[model samples]
Target: MAATIIDVARRAGLSTATVSRALRGLPNVSESARARVQQAAEELSYTVSPIASQLSSGRTGAVGVVLPFVNRWFFGQVVSGIDSVLRANDMDLLLYNLGDTRVHERFFERMPVRRRVDALIVLTLPLSEDETRALSSLAVPVAVLGEPTPPFWNVRIDNSVAAATAVRHLVNLGHRRIGLITGAAHDPRRFATPILRRDAYRTALEAAGIRYDPRLEAMGHFGIEEGAAAMAQLLTLPEPPTAVFAESDEMAFGALRTLRRMRLRCPEDVSVIGFDDHETAHLMDLTTIAQPVVEQGALLARLVLKALAGSHEEPSDTVLPTRLVVRGTTGVARRDAAPGVPPSPGAATDNGTGARGARSPVP
Candidate 1:
């Protein structure tokens, strides 16, 4: 049978509270006492119960991660990084997937994770000012993975910069009428990422002396199907764009599929670019702006763990770098011909970029 905390206390000739404090590395316990408790526990072959230790120390030995969607590729990669860190630290992970708006409302209204986790990590969930204030009032330390809000530790990439870079690539390829396919925003005024990326798209076009054409923009839910549908809408316009930039790799794939369905060749007919250098980007020969998605998740977990370890210092905001990867999808703009020109029968075909949101190798 395993020895309990009482047995260690008795062996070390100390009170149960002192044994608990020393064994758990809580402050106010002298180093000599801590050494004595360690020796006694070793001799008795006693192991501390994580649950009891947490209870006495006012901790839960777990971190809660709340995300808008768990099934998505980006979220999956982030969760993998966070899970790896938690496992090494002997802490458990409690995942709360807010499936939709109703779930988000209910979760925030209750704040069910209160007292259930030692720390919390929120992954790019757009919240209102009221909700943000409510979260700040929670007892546990909070870390966010996108756009840093006040009083919270954050690790994120500049969405606007990434978007601008993607646009610049298409513009440099001599694409005059560039179309944009981006995620739909519920509220454009929430100061969220969709708005930032969209605004950046327009800014980049204007800087290049190109007019921001409303007819050249399409909205999607950031899914492959939605992207394909949106691309179809842009393609049917009287003056279709010479190139298109999708806000995400999945959307880019959809656009590619649409072009293929229409028997139009990429770059030869329409250039396609996307953000997020997904694993399969190389496979599909996609040109995209790559961000450190997995690293962001790992960093968020590290911040939460540091706070849980009695480090009261606030961590500085971290902005990761992004780079544009040129692959097969993007090419020099083709000469203008009659509107809606299809590719020749012998036009070269490239592989489609299927969704492979694997953990990106950190540079």
Candidate 2:
């Protein structure tokens, strides 16, 4: 029913191969031939088949986007960005969501993407040695959106610096007793974010001459319920922290909900800060570190496309900027100090240097 390459070639008075090359804008096709092929195609209302194009070019014209969880906010935003670019470039996206250890292991073992996609964009998915080897052996160009992994094009923010900046914000607010709620370190898909944040929290305290109190730390598993539970446990401690920091906006929301249930006035009783300037963070009035989550996805997708087009070479990582965003949730330490000890002295100032700071689930 539709015109094929043969029809276009005959109509344009050129060979089929010439017509194909001309339509695709491949080298060696003269401008006159390309124009003739275009005119013929338009006259016949003909469109090239994507499958046939791939077969001829030896390219899938598709990208494999691998993420640990797609339903999470960060991943969803990232996916949206990637999808936008892929769509504009006339390419398809084959998403791979490794929601559990079994699924993750199976995907890596099979490495099916090698045969189905032209390039890969891995979003904060940590790889074991074997997995890394498998990915490298796939011979597909890979782009990562997280911490830098050698031999792969990457886009990321410095987690350590971002976390330190967050903690420093609280410190500048005259809060000496700071507590942290972090994700579980032992999770199968665990990456360096939580660990790096936790370490930076301690480092921030040390820099301010505050003692590192292990009792002030709680593991929230990066969930709302877990954050609430962790906050509840912290509240039960002998001397609760004056301020708390959740590693993600979701966790911070959970912590804030728990504080409300306990009739604790934010900033007046316990100042709370979180990472990721999630859309809801403003609604919650949460003070947080904002990272360009969606932009990272867009950048990685661009790199993937470039590599697939045989344009990107000399592997390099793109480190994005981050910034602290102060809001109503965080403030100066409560004035109700102990009988003798004075509250740490500092004005409550938003320390966001307009520089920057998730891999939290979306829902």
Candidate 3:
């Protein structure tokens, strides 16, 4: 029979509580006691029964991670990061894909999380204050990841900063007529992240003395099809934008495809920038803003662990920073004259100052 904690405690000549503390590496257990407990466990071929440990100790040894969408690269990468740490801590992960409103509503309403897992982690769950309160009433630890659905432990990157970086990159590249494409704001409860991003983009433009052009901004679904369509729409304008900043790399990839179809060469006729530095972004030589998605996951794991231990009570919204990544997609505005167009300008130099002029002919 596999040795149990009782067997190890007996061999170590210590109480079962001390042996448990030593095995869990709790600070109260002395070093000598810990060493003896370890040796005794090895001699007895002892292994912990996670199920029994939870039953007796009142912990499930498992955590439930709820994400609105797992198919997206950003959420998948964050979940992968969370899994890495939880596995090391001997915790099992149960994933809940609550992408659909109907499914999520039913799940939250049923409140099935009671006693099923020690803690919960939500990734951009599209939750309101009332829904968050309902989940908290489950009386277990909860950690939120990405786009804060607050009154819970949170780990997220600043969406506004991310948006600003993309716009600034285009502005600094001598592209004054810059367009922004992001998730649709038509649905408030659905696409909150994109709305925050658009706010940041507008703020950056305003700071640079650029008049926010409604024509230069469009709503897009968070996928390739919308990305392509958004780009095509921007290009079709009579005074087409010289640059495009997409809220996501996947969307930018779609835009790139659109540019190819129209024979519009990058950095010659237009410039492009995207966020999330996805692997494909590098393959396509796209400029972007890189943030640590996986690191956010690791933080979520730690937060959940704290919650399970009843140690994390105060909710927090943490914002990670971002940096600009220059690539082959952006450059000085190219002079493409229309028929009978008056040309009195040379190459528009950026001097690294973003958005020096808006709604004016390129210098």
Candidate 4:
């Protein structure tokens, strides 16, 4: 039969309560008793029951992560970061993926995570007033990754600034006719990130003294296949754009694929840039606005821990920084390169940095 606390207490020559307190590292147990309990536990291979420990402490020993899409690369990276911190702290993770509308609605209606986790981490999902109230009623620490929800800890990057930097990069490369592939147009949930990015794209164009043409904007809906279709649609325009800025690297990958299928050379024909310097962006030589994806998640987890520990008094917002990563996918626009035609092989490949060398891959 497996060893239990009783066996450990008997072998240690101490009361069961003393053995339990020593094993749990609770105060009031002397060093001698703790050593004896440790030796006895090792000798009998005895371990405390996690269920019993949780019941006694009234803590589930888990953090709940609620996100819209678990399958997306960005979300996966964030979750990995969150899990790393939580795991190191001896805590478990419970994921709630509200990808489907029905599931999202049901989650708020049922409030399943109530009393099931010590804290909650919410990712970029726009919450309604009622839904926000429902989450608040859980009475646990909540940290959000996007916009600041008053009374909740928040961590995020400035979407408007990062997105504007991407469009401005293309404009500085001498591209007048720029296209935008955005996810906001088709999102039923009205996620704040996509909307902010799309608006920034328009504002950047105006700042560059360029007219904002709706025809140059396509609905990518934040998916690879959707991005490809959106790129194809832009190519069908009467006067297609000389460069394209995709709101996500996954969508940028699709745009690159479409360019390849059409036998059009990147930068030489249609320069491309993306947001979120995803892991594969370097492999694809994509220029993008790099946000600290994993670090944001780790920060959110740390904030939740601080709140749970009673160290964090008031709700706080932490906005991480973002930078532009230049790579081979974006370069100086060829003035004579027309739609459906690639520039001459000897055309300048300057990446708008005034340097005339091979573009180095982004790490």
- Deviation in Å, model 4, residue 132 alpha carbon: 1.8
For residues 1-363, could you state the per-residue lDDT of candidate 2 as single tens digits? 889899999999999999988877799988888999999999999998888889888888889999988777778989998999999998899999999889999998888798788999898888888887888998988998888888889899988899999999988988888899997666867777888889999999999999988999998988889899998888887788878989998889889888777766676567899998988999888999999988888888889888877784877988999999998888776445652122333223232443210111111
Task: Compare the candidates by lDDT and give the number of the best one.
Answer: 4
- The regions of model 4 sitting more than 4 angstroms off are 8-19, 27-43, 337-363
lDDT of 4: 0.88
* Per-prediction TM-score to the true structure, in the order listed: 0.84, 0.85, 0.78, 0.89
Worst 10 residues of 2 by lDDT: 354-363
Pairs of residues at least 3 apart in sequence or in different chains that clash in candidate 1: none
Q: Score each candidate by Cα lDDT.
A: 0.83, 0.84, 0.78, 0.88
Error of 3 at 115 (Å): 1.4
Error (Å) of candidate 2 at residue 214 is: 2.7
List runs of model 3 lying over 4 Å from the truth: 1-49, 147-150, 309-313, 336-363
Between which residue pairs do clashes occur in model 4? Answer: none
Model 4, residue 51: C-alpha shift (Å) = 2.0
Comparing 2 and 3 on TM-score, the stronger one: 2
Clashes of each: 0, 10, 0, 0
